[model samples]
Target: MSDHEVVDEKPEVESTPKTTETATEAPEDTTAATPKPEGNDGGEESGDDMPPLEDIKYDDETDDAVKKKRIVIPEDKPKPKPAEDGWLDVLDNGELRKFVLTPGAVGQPRPERGCIVAIKLVVKLEETQAVVESESHELTDMIVGDSDLFQGLDLIIPLMDQKEVARVVVSSRFAYGKTGIPGAIPPDASLDCELHLLSVQWLDEEFVLPIVDRIRIGNRKKERGNFWFGRQEYSTCIQCYKSAIKLLDATDEELESLDTNELKEHFDQQMKGEKKSPEDEERVKELVDIRGVTYNNLAMAQMKIDDFSGALTSVEAVLVTQPNNVKALFRKGRILAEKGELEDAIKVLKTGLTLEPDNKAIAQELNKYSAKRKKELVTERDLYKRMLQTDKSSPPTTPSKGLWGRSSVTGLGVECNC
Candidate 1:
């Protein structure tokens, strides 16, 4: 779920569903930083328009062909003709087709990969044109490539311009895949969509983006992670969380190192945050919140997939920023317990309990790990001690050679016992 305020729903047409989720940020790459543009909505065209329909063959011989592909508009049905002033784009033998009803605003930025996009859309069955699902203009924020979107939408979104409204038809192979959503959509149904691109957020452009925009982007990613987590997709969930962490990672190492009181206090306040606002301090606080939650969620998801080592790393990231974060400590303790590090598990659980004195889960974990450690210690102690003593007391003996120069079973040897 992302913070995209959902206003309505229909038969599910969009590849990714609308969710109300807060997101997290990733580290910035400024290697090719461009000058801050005048507005957020505008970009160079994707240059991804495939060859004309006549140039493509829908038969099985085609590369990345869709088997038993369904036609978007049957030969007899009326087809949309792009207005001379608008954008018409197609790909993959018509698996993806975009006909822009409204041209993008002049000078508006077109979203690219790694950008966050806000969109409103309704999906329908192509033949019947019956609506399946719709997210209202209130919108949903989708991260371009990372959204776990259907292949067609994934390919089409980056080519869209902010505030541009278009009609999109994605084939079954790129819509819901071969096995479509049960009850909501029939198998092999191409999705007919009316898409609205409301805005875009450039994560890497530092100067052009307002702080609030960045905060929203990070939080949206966090919520997207939650969406995947809810579906029991642990790997995808972890990826969403890590993406947020990267977005929220401190961009200026030197400034963070100054150790100024105001800066230190602000960082501290992020964990114990103040009221939300749009100012830098408030935005920073929001980012920290998103980062902590993202890491915590990442650790939990990793644990689900039995990636205890990775889970440990994720939780430790939270612990680095918020040492007393009980959730991180709890997750770390669980990861350690999974790794059979009962001692470390017990220690972390104990620390967490001290922080949240009334926490019963931590208390239980502490008791369980402590008992396990005690059991292990008691079982191994005397046995290892006797073996050590015997080894120390006994002198080593060399094997005597047999007739064929091989070591013999009756060779001279030493035996030791308690």
Candidate 2:
């Protein structure tokens, strides 16, 4: 306590002068600060108030930074306008519209030029929706690009696929032009058409081969023909079978040149070299058999349509390869019978019965023909006998001149005297 008191007394007296000297220096410092730039003063004031630069974080991944960093942008994006329920602008022009009622089969075949298409359609006025012409229940078949359809339909149907349903609107230019549909569609009237594409089929060989293996394609045609035949659609059945026959190349030249013995020999050689499978031989045989069957089927369909001459030709074609085919022989006989060639019909039926003696159908047909022939012979014999008998019973009519030069009944009573 004694030492602190002595030191405090001496220091306090000296410190008072030092403080006055520092106070005098402060005025000089203030005068120098006043001359400093105003910008520097503001900078210092801001720096003093703000947090340290190192302490504050700056985001490197903000949206603004990312936007500035991007370089590429796409141009001309397509934006489709929403259409009304069941309606769409197919061409993005008001002139052509499509309203889908029922979706079609996926990946179905569309009609192409030279293809045959079948459809059910209904035509109406676009403004009034009044029915004009309709084919609703039955399918109308047309050969694409060749048939006489409405100009609008010709352009539009080829764009449809099988089993598809839609209503299409067409402007006057695409429809029946200035002429319009007389007594039905008015002049320059926009048409609303309901369409159902039932089928698309190509009859051209070159077009079909690329889509399916030749044999399988022919088989499918054969099956379709049989289906139509079962439904008694003879015309359609004949067309289908003809298409199948064409695909098989069952021509006179081809059939004549096809030698199964040669085919078997070649197949045997290939088999010996292990280059051919048993299926190859089987396929060859099957192709030959299919050709014969197709001919027979064609003949049957022809018969149903009363195409007797055509049926005969087809049956003869079958018999060329399979002379003993029961069905071919029966069909040939039936066709001959229809042509009134009874003798030839009997001969054919007898030949068929020789091959298949147990076939009741052939036997029955033969018996019926035999009975008919006997009846005809009997009837003719009776007719001839009756004619002779009648001639014998009836007196001959003649005008005899008497002495008076007048017609007299000479055979009455005076015949004995004469």
lDDT of 1 by residue, 1-418 (tens): 2243111120033553433322221234445655544433454322123222222224564543233433342255344444465545454355677887787875767788777678877888999988875322345567777754545766777777778888888888776656676777788898888888888878655432333544676677777777666656666667777776766775342135333324444443443554433254445555666777787777777777788888888889878767888878887888899998888888889889998999877797888889889999988998899999999998666556666666654423532221
Q: Please list the residue runs of candidate 1 whose C-alpha ends up more than 4 Å from where it truly belongs after superposition.
A: 1-111, 116-118, 125-142, 148-151, 159-165, 170-190, 197-208, 250-282, 385-418
**Model 2, position 93: C-alpha lDDT score:** 68
lDDT of 2 by residue, 1-418 (tens): 1121111112123631222222112222232233344555433222223223222333454643232322233355464433867566655667667776777876866788767677888878989999875322344445555323444666667666578898989888766556565677788889888988888877745342321244675666676666556646567667777867766653332233345323333334423544434455455556657767877888877877789999999989878777887888987888998998888899999999998889888899899888888888899999999999998999896667766576666666663222
RMSD of 1: 19.1
Among all candidates shown, the one with the greatest TM-score? 1
Cα lDDT listed for each candidate: 0.66, 0.65
Q: State the lDDT at 312 in candidate 2.
A: 99
TM value for model 1: 0.58
Q: lDDT winner among the candidates?
A: 1
